[model samples]
Target chain A: MVLLLVAPAVAAGIVLLLPSARAIMRFCAMGTITTATVAACCAWRTFAGGSLQAGEWFRMDMLSAWHLVLMAGVFSAVSLYAVGYFSKELESGAFSRGKAARYAALWFGAMDAMTVVLLTDNLGVMWVGIEATTLLTAFMILTHSSPASLEAMWKYLLMCSVGVALAFIGVILAAASAESAGLTGAQVLSWTHLLDAAGSLSSAHVKMAFIFAVVGYGTKAGLAPMHSWLPDAHSQAPAPVSAMFSAFMLNAALYCVLRSLALVEAVTGSDGWGREVLLVLGLVSVLLAAVFIVGQRDIKRLLAYSSVEHIGLIAVGIGLGGAGAAAALLHAMNHSVAKTLSFMSAGRIGQAYGTNDMRRISGALHAEPLWGTGLLLGIMMLAGMAPFGIFLSEFLILKSALEGGRYLLAGALLAGLVAVFVGVMRHAIGVSWGAHEGIVRNVGAGWLDRFLVAGAILVSLVLGIWPCSRLWHVLEMASALTGGMP
Target chain B: MMPLVDSVHVLILVTCLLLLGSSRLGACIRTVAIQGIVAGGVLPWVSSLHISMQLLFTGVFVMALKGIVFPVLLSRAMREASASREMSPFVGYGTSLMAGVLFFLASLWLGAKLPTPDGVSGLAVPTACMMVSTGLFLIIARRLAVTQVIGYIVVENGIYALGLAVAHDIPVLVELGAMLDAFVAVFVMGIAIFHINREFDHMDSGRLNVLKG
Candidate 1:
């Protein structure tokens, strides 16, 4: 567990201090990410044995273990894709060697910070981890800082920082609830202590705390109404960062919400209020994403909206509980796999055409066939096409909703998803099939790039059709971490 | 006779009122500085939950960071951005002042209704609430990016005040960590503001209307 956190931070420091040799830096980054990934996977496999409790500062329970596995999964893929990404950027002279080295370092910093969030037993440190990612990724968002990227970074930093500050209020209130439970000093802010005393914590404070938590962290999670920053930041961020943001960053934010929700429900005795609120917000996010996807010109923005929709679906599933909770975990895993593929493919397609505008850059398959096909396939799965995990996951959520007697919510979710499916397919198909009028600059996707994308899609498919037995047990454990579970 | 802490709380509220109606960026910065210094006064009760030594260190440290350090960063950002004075207020002075009063009234009403835990200082909740309302209003009601950053600082102060009411004896390590993160957040934003100045001759976020949906 310690190694999983330290490897990335150490990599970041070494990457920063190295002479500006891109290959050396890339090699270092890959080595550290591989170490972290293997360690995390080991933890995940053995999680049912018991949690790895490291003092009071960090722990890896079944919940953290699974999230750690998923976070590392995305990191591994993004790290591989980044090699191809930076190679293209270097060839284009967009990243001088120094700039590339700095990029490598910041990438690791973000990875380290998020790893901390997943593993921390101290909510205060978790808040710091989340805030640090905002800062680290602010730099990453504009590796080759342009005016637009700067604007995006500015909005992201300010909005997320403010949102996170509100989350601090939630943290304080949670700790205060501990005060009522007769805990004090450091134990007040410690997750283990709070969880142990959760049943006796003040209900009013917990309820008040969660409202700010939902709004504050919800902004970070890109739940609609508070999601104004999502499209701009996601669209303008460099492609790999977009992949990280969608695949794991929002999940990190949502992870905090889950931690808070579990406590709230524990204190309030599972009265169902928390789940209902999540249901409303989740459906609203889907509806908003469906509306946004229809008119998006930027392909990255289009994928960004799809992420919002997918996250909404996951939220709804979590909201439904019982089977819904398991389904939500499965859905998050599925979405991360597919969304990473979609973003990376869009990156390549954008590179090939030198613009993200879908209308302007047509005939992607004609030029960069590998990525174009990947993009089309990614969209096919994202639109919840048959045999895809996302489809299965969404179907399970609807099934859970019906089983829970939430037919109206199930109907609304179905409608919103179908609307997005049609609109995204139309846009994706148009971009993939046509001949782009503009000059194509990027060399076609390399073997490694194609393998990563295909592997991601393959993982999603396997999870859909025949999820391994171990994975089902892991899902059960993950679902049990939340209050939504029966 | 009112306790010294009560007077300090009043000053914090007054600073918010003064900031809400004031258009001069420099004055707003100074007012925040004074508020920062005054907020140090909140820490001095002799019974002392934790070690008095640690409390003294925290008070002086917060006073220095909020009073002196942040103001320097902001003023530097203000100068580089080269727009001294707000020039335009999204919510004008007269209306903003009205909102400030309303913010106070609302905080009072809400504070009255909030469930306070046993033995908490009564003024903490209402003071924190007013600070939050004024800060959010400051963020929305301003056009310049720099002022918005200041609004964020104001919001942090409010959160800090709320932290005091609940969670007494917050771990010194976590408290310092939070403060350090706030400093870094401000520093990062300050650098970005400098770039915003370089990219466009002015830091008017209104000009940032280009990337709209």
Candidate 2:
């Protein structure tokens, strides 16, 4: 477990010694692969055995292990896509070796920090890990610093910093509740220890803590009302960075919120107060994203809003709490896969067309067929079309909500999803096959690019169609760890 | 020890009011620096558990970073930006000061509602809450980016004080890690301010509205 955290930091250091921009990008891919391999081992061990721990600080159970596997998959895919995405910049002289080195280092640093968030048993350390990710990735957003990117970077840095700082109040309160329950020293901050002592904890303190936590971490997770930074940052950042942010970073923040919800539910005797908070935030996020997606001009911002929508759905699923939690975990995986492909394709398509404005850039299929199809299918999948993992997950969430007799919640969610489907499909169809002017110079796709796009589609398809028993079992174990099941 | 902690908390609250009322950026930076020092200096005395060598070391470390280093960084950023006084803040100085007092009263009310552990000083939660509210007010009500950074520091200072009040048993490693994050946050914000000033020729964050919906 220690090695999982240490390897990425070491890789970050090693990347600084690389020679050229291309070399740095390649090194990032290799580094991510190595770390993912280590993570897979840890996750497998957690699955085979019960949990894994290193000393008193770091531990991984079914919950973190599940997130660990998803994070590794997303990071690996995004790292490979970074190589392709930056290659064009390399030719255009926009990407320098220095920039590449810095990006690679921050990439690894973010990976390491998130690993700490997932592996650490101490909630304080987890909070630290999340903060470190915010600081580390601030620069990556400005990979090609323009006025707009700088603006995005500033808003991101300030909003997330202040917001996550509020989360510290939550952490402190949780600690207070545990300490009031007679835990001492490091035990006060340990999640496992707090879970054991949840029965004796002060419910009032836990309630306050959970509310503060949802708001604070919810800000970082791009839950609405606090999601102002999401679109701006996504629109301005280089594509791979946007993918990483959309794919795993938001989930990581949401993961922290989920961890807090688990504790809150346990302390309050699982009466669903915490889940109710999540449900409200989740619904707000979905409906709000639907509103924003309707007339969005910037394609990247459109995808960004879609991210808020998907994350909202996941939160709602977890909020529904039985099969809903399991469905939420599955939704997380589906969203990561589909979102990665969409960002990569939109990035390339934007590069070909010289703008991200959906109305301005058309005939995507005529311009670059490979990425255009990727974007089209990716958006189709994202809109929760059948035979895709997202559709499956959304269906399952709705089923669970119906089973639980949350008719109002289910109706609202269905309304939001249908609105988003119409809004996004309009933009997607226009971008894919609508009329255009000048011939877009083809940026030829490499074999790896083809492989990535095909592989993502295949994964989404298979997961939707099959969802093997092993996967379902693992999802159940992870959701069970969340402890809201009746 | 209780009285000492409470007095320092009052001193910290006074600095927050000074920060809100001061129109000059330089003075605001100095006031926050003083608040940092007071907040950090009171850490050892405010522990709910016995203070150890590690706790004292952590306290001095935070004090130096928050009190000494962060002020220097903010001052340098301010000089580079060359915007001296906060000209016509969204809220005037007198009103901001009034708002600060109202925040204190509200925090007191909130503190009464919250049940603290046995060893906690009565004023700690209220003081921390006041600092957090005033800091948030500064962020929303100020025009200059530099002031916003100061507001962020005050918010963090409040959180640190809260940590001291409630959970002194937090692992030293995690505490230092949090402090490191705070340091880097300020450092990163300073660099961002430099870039923003260069690009836009002003640090008025309110005018950074080009990327809106």
Candidate 3:
């Protein structure tokens, strides 16, 4: 776990000193893979019941363990893809070596910051981590020297910063509520201690705190009404960075929501309030994605909406609680893997075609077979097609929703998923096989690209067909950590 | 004997209303600055421990940075951008002013409903809550980025007001860190607005909708 946190920070330092763009890319890739290995180890040990901590400041439990693994895995793949992706740009001299090196450093820095967010138990420190990620990745979003990219970066920074400020209000309120309960000093805000004393916390204040936290973190999670910045940020950012944003960063935000939900549930003794809020927000997000995905011209933006849809699903799962919480955890893992693959494939496709417009991109299978196949397969999985883990998880969410006597919510969720499926399929088919006009070969697939796509696909399929007992155990443990029935 | 804290509470409430009702961005910034200075003035009265010279210096620094320096920087940015008036907001200024009044009333209701923690006076907590919510409203209602930044400062000021009410032993380091983060965040936003203007050819976010879905 410590290695996972420190590796990127170390790599960021090394990346700054590297002489050439090639060296920088190699350093980052090596660091990412190393971090991923450490994360996998953390996940394994956490499942095996081995604990690690940095005094009281940081600790690894089943929850953080799962997130650490996912963050590192997705980052590793994206970092590898970035190497090939950025090298092509450098070779074409579209970007100077200096700019590429900066991108590498910032990418690692963002990864390091995200790891800190997942690992830290301190609420204030976690805010700092989230803010650090925003600062580091905002530059990455504007890597392209276009007005659109610059505009997107500004909107992302401004809106998210404001949202984060609101979240701080929520944190302060929670602390105040704790103080009212006689839990003074650091204990008032500590997650572990707060959870233990949650039942004693003021219900009204905690409820208000939860509302603020949800909206604040929901913005980062790309939940609708607060998700205006997402499409711009995702579409305008470099492809690998977009992949990381959709796959891992969104999950990181959801992690915060889940943490807060746990406290809210404990204090309230009923998930009804949290569930109602999440259901409304989640359904709106799905419907919004459905509306926007149909009209989306940029393929990356289309995928960004798709992210909104998947996050909505996870939110709904969490709101249901019980088995739904477990399912949500599983779905989080599956979605991160599948969505990262989808974005990476889209990035490569966009690079090859020189445009993200579906109208201009066609016959991808004929033009670039490996990337084309990756994009098609990734899209199929993302659309919740059979034989993918996403389909299984969505089914579980529906089942859980129905079992909880939320028949109306279950029906709405099903309807929304179907709408999203149709909307995404329409765009995916249009880009994959619609027409064969004006396809350019600016970049082609390499072994690393093939490896990432194949790895993501293999994991998703394997989990769908045969859930690993170990992974299930981890999910169960994570559920228990949230004070839910495992 | 009238409670001294009640006077502080009234002062903060008036300042919050001035912030909400003020049209000029310069005046709004000055109001926030005054609120910060007043907050510093109340710090010694509220604290259980004797104020050390270092703590006094820290309070002065907070007043200088948050109260004075930040607003001046925002005022300079506003002047440079040539945006003097708070443009027509999403919510009308009249509606917002009414909403601010309602928020003050709601905070009073909330404080009355809940049991106040021992040693914590009831008056300031409710007022602080109202101020915080109004500051959030200002951020959401206003259009210009600079105005929104000032709104954020007001929200933090409200939180600081609450901090004074409880008088908990938060580490000076943490307080300094929070202030530093806010300073840097505003600085970055200022730089970003300059870029937004250069790139989009306007600083008004109303026109900055190129990447929306």
Q: Which stretches of candidate 2 lie over 4 Å from their true place?
A: B1-3, B46-51
Per-model DockQ against the true two-chain complex: 0.76, 0.81, 0.45
Could you give the CAPRI-style class of model 1? medium
Deviation of model 2 at B177, angstroms: 1.3
Sorting all predicted structures by lDDT, with the top scorer first, yields: 2, 1, 3
Q: A401-449 in candidate 1: lDDT tens per residue?
A: 9998988988888899889988998898899886678578856667888
List the per-model TM-score of the A chain. Answer: 0.97, 0.99, 0.97
What RMSD, rounded to one decimal, does every model reach?
1.7, 1.4, 2.5
- The clash numbers for all candidates, in the given order, read 2, 0, 0
Instruction: Point out the worst 10-residue segment of candidate 2 chain A by lDDT.
Output: A434-443
Which tens-of-lDDT digit does each residue in A108-173 have in candidate 3? 888888888888876666767777777778889978878888888878887787777677666766
Better of 2 and 3 by DockQ: 2
| Strongest candidate by TM-score | 2
TM-score of each: 0.97, 0.98, 0.94
Docking class of 2: high
Residue range B4-73, candidate 1, lDDT tens digits: 5577778788899999988999999999888766655353342234557877888788888998899999
Residue lDDT tens for model 2, A137-184: 999999998999999999999999999999989998888888668898
